[model samples]
Target: MYETYTTVIGTVVSDPRHRQTSTGEPVISFRVACNSRRIDKRTQEWIDGPTLYLTVSCWRRLLTGVSQAVAKGRPVIAHGQIKTNEYVTADGERRADLEMTATAVGLDLSRCVVSFEGAPGREPSVAGTTTRPVGSEVEGAGADAQTPTAA
Candidate 1:
């Protein structure tokens, strides 16, 4: 009936795992670590706070881009619906995993500089076709047209 959405800004903690589902749909999953920080008002010094870790999953067409773009230790922003995976351990302890089925993910530009590169294997579009390559510049396609550059 309701869904919870979250946006996480953090460093990628693990390399993206790319695989196809049993039905042959592409998917990519990765972990991220977000830590809290605060500046003490009186001392005016920044201090580290607790860290929260979460797993992010991207599906379908988003998989290729996510797999190629994300890597361990890189800062990224991920947004998606939050889901809780609950289970019981062998020793009878209850545990939960925080995961997000990511609708979008990208580099955290505020923390680092990054260059945009077009997705590989994209096909060029022809006239009257609605599909275009990930980063192709179409002549006379209007102001939104973007020329892909080498990173």
Candidate 2:
């Protein structure tokens, strides 16, 4: 199944962890927290919901970018596919984790500033070089939000 997923700009709630798979693939994973506010009809006030926590996995070039540019408590935007993983714990309990297999990850420069790794004669720019906006939905690219499942 093919899916596309995107994440709202948020803070990295935890330190990123780098690991190698059984196949020796390098991967980095981190958690981000985003909060949304909606107005309460009766009270006519805005209230926040439980912050949404998304696990982001970076691979290959994105892995390199994330390692170089992202850190705990850093503001960032990640776009990719939402992966729901089901597993049984050692205690025999089943758990599910929501993760994003990130195709694009970047430092959100709107609020706080982040320094990028500078190579000789090069300055990194996350604006135009990093990601495509969430608004641009690619044709036939089935996003996780649009996908149907047996739930």
Q: Best by lDDT, which number? A: 1
Cα-based lDDT at residue 128, candidate 2: 21
Give per-model TM-scores: 0.72, 0.69
Local accuracy by lDDT, each model: 0.75, 0.72
**Residue 84 accuracy (lDDT) in model 1:** 90
Task: Report the C-alpha lDDT of model 2 over 5-38, residue by residue, as the tens digit.
Answer: 6666787898899999999999999999988789
Model 1, span 15-134: residue lDDT tens: 888888899888889999999999999999999899999999999766656766677877789999998999999999999999999999987767654444344687532221122233
Which runs in model 2 stand beyond 4 Å of their true positions? 38-46, 115-151
* Worst window of 10 by summed lDDT in candidate 2: 142-151
- Root-mean-square deviation (CA) per prediction: 8.7, 13.1
